[model samples]
Target: MSIENPQPLSINSMAALVTLGKFLEEDQWFPQLLENKRIYRVTYSGKNGQFVCFAQIMNKTSIIMCMEETYESKVQW
Candidate 1:
């Protein structure tokens, strides 16, 4: 059956949205993936470990860089 209305976001989903909004606004992390790729994938490392995120080529213009990550050890890139 087709539904006319959609369900509201769960509490966890809402929290994720807010967290992602803050992350995108304040985090300046991006990966230098394969050459000529339209999308870039990056991993963010924190005290809790690493998580993955990505951005599209067209979205680069609107992305804001609030901070850059510093590693205690040397990284490949």
Candidate 2:
């Protein structure tokens, strides 16, 4: 759904558009987002409790808003 029709999503729409992996071009935005206070390091809870990742935070929101997750993350490229 996300690839075919990328648009604003809502519960009333019956589903949401989500991406599995982002493109390399998108990584360019991360640094600026960090400087703008829109993204930061997060524990990114996992089975082993030994992971760290970055999350884009919504304006005037709490970090706890993110759900518990386990991602096969890559820290250094």
Q: Would you list the C-alpha lDDT of every candidate in the order shown?
A: 0.47, 0.35
User: How do all models score by TM-score?
Assistant: 0.30, 0.23
lDDT per residue as tens, model 1, 15-62: 554555456556665444434333345667766456565543222132
In terms of lDDT, the best-performing candidate is 1
Point out the worst 10-residue segment of candidate 2 by lDDT. 15-24
Q: Superposing every Cα of model 1 onto the true structure, what RMSD results?
A: 13.1
RMSD of 2: 12.9
Tens-digit lDDT string for candidate 2 (20-74): 1132125532222244333444443334455455554332332323444544573
Instruction: Report the alpha-carbon TM-score of model 2 versus the true structure.
Output: 0.23
Model 2: per-residue Cα lDDT at residue 61: 34
